[model samples]
Target: MRHRRIGRSGLLVSEISYGNRFAHRESANCARAALEAGITTFHTAAAWGHGAAEEALAEGLREARRDDIVLCTGVFWLEHPGASQFGLGRKHLMSSLHGSLRRLGTDHVDVFQLWRFDHRTPLEETFLALSDVVREGKVRYVGTAEWTAEQLLRADALANELRVPLLCNHAHYSMLWRAPESQVMPAAARAGIGHFASMPLAQGILTGKYRQQRIPPGSRADNDERGRSAVRPFLDASLLERVDLLRGIAEEAGLTMAQLAIAWALHHEGVASAVVGASRPAQVAENARASGVELGIDVLTQIDQLLGGFVQSDPRLTFTPTQYDDL
Candidate 1:
């Protein structure tokens, strides 16, 4: 697998990383397959399966060398209702990291990310806590996910002030969602922070299995209420019809629709990695192969023309739980 450093930091990750958020009862199998496929980075969060995901990932990586893999996890939106259990406050961050380290059977994690921007907590406190974790040897590099472009720039500035290298912004960017391209990527580019495009597959919609427009049994569209809701907004008649057209482009490129989608996200210059969550081992391997596939300029442009009006590009139009009213 091809690997790249996160932003200006020395922490390297595979072009195709594995995340266990939606991995199933066979998560161990998927994780093992990732390691076998040379996937060094694995992502989990305190909110996934209430920590079952972390333990399952550790079980899968039990036989691999510790230093050979990068364990990247985040904290936010916990199951608990306590006031102190959900935000990026120092107390919650420390508690969450300690719990994650213990669950993963490690003393330190390679990258500790804030799953969301906690508007209630001061950014100053959040950055300070993140810096403290690096000093305490619990976290190597600090990052965030699903944050607005303005929040990311302010975060980069604070990290610079605190001298803590903010490694990357793990945002929702894909063939269907181009909001990050509007301002997030440019802001990160100016701040020297890398970008990890989460949800590159659009919750399996880009896999082309849905091209027939039939909801397959046991698939995410059938079983996942949240997943269904997540993709519901984007599955319009025009976009769905356009996906059928996209299949031809994928065929011409000698790639699957899923592969084409992932490669499309990676085609962006600032994207250090594209994080893919798979429910099965074969999905893991299939996504792993998308690492080195290159699309030519003509194919890329053709794809742009076909799916042009369907994508979400404006960051202002981007919806997230937290907004920068302070901006």
Candidate 2:
């Protein structure tokens, strides 16, 4: 697998990393397969499978050296009782990290990210808490997930003021979802922060399984109701046409649709790593194969035209405003 430096850090990670949601036993096998395929990075979230996924990954790491795999996890959806589970309140973040440590079977994570930007918590409080983790050696670096460019800039400036390392930001980016270019990618590049792209396949929409008038059996659309709902607004007739055009490009390149999608993300200069979530070992292998193939500028331009002018019009795009009353 090809390796790239994560932000300005000397640490180099594989272009494609493994991600797990809940498949404990299955994820263990997947990790092994990923290691065999030369994928050295693994990402999981505390909220993933409600923490069961981290437990399984920790169990899998028992067979490998700690340094052999670069482990990362985020704190989101932890039980916060009175406070919102999504933010970075001190009580909530401390409780959540302890729980994540217990589940991951590690005291420190390579990169500890907040699952989302906590608009509620005072930036100072959140930054201090993150700095404390690094100071105490419980986390090597800090990051945020699903945050906008403004939030990232504010956090980086805070990190600079506090003399702490703010390493990266994690968000979803793929051929189908190119929204990061407008702000997130540029902000990260300017601030020397890594941008790890999640869901490189657009929740399997770009996998070339769905066709005109036929949704493939066992696809995310068939099996994941929430995923289908999330894509409904974007899946209008025009987008379907775009998907078909994208399919032709993939076919011409002699690669699978998933491979082309992942390659698109990895081809970017600003992307530190593309996190791939797989249900099976074969899926992990297929994703790892993408690191080797690079899409040329001509291919990217064609894809841009085919998929341009699309917006995330799904209802889920506008989430309930974050709770800041407690702060």
Could you tell me every candidate's TM-score relative to the true structure?
A: 0.94, 0.90
Question: Which candidate achieves the best TM-score against the true structure?
Answer: 1
Q: How many backbone clashes does candidate 1 have?
A: 0
| Candidate 2: tens digits of C-alpha lDDT, residues 1-327 | 988988877778899998877654578888888888898888988776677888888876677888877889887565434445566878778878888888888878888887777666798998888888888988888877877778889988999998777878787887767667777777888999887888888877788565563566755566677767765655567777787788789989988888899999888788888999776889889888888797888998998888877734232332223764533
lDDT of candidate 1 over 209-323, digit per residue (tens): 6654567676777887886777677567778888778889999998989999999999998998999987789989989999988889999898889988887777875445654
Show the lowest summed lDDT stretch of 10 residues, model 2. 311-320
lDDT of 1 at 303: 85
Every model: Cα RMSD to truth: 2.7, 3.2
**Per-candidate local distance difference test:** 0.84, 0.78
- Residue 153 local lDDT, model 1: 85
Against the true structure, candidate 2 has what lDDT?
0.78
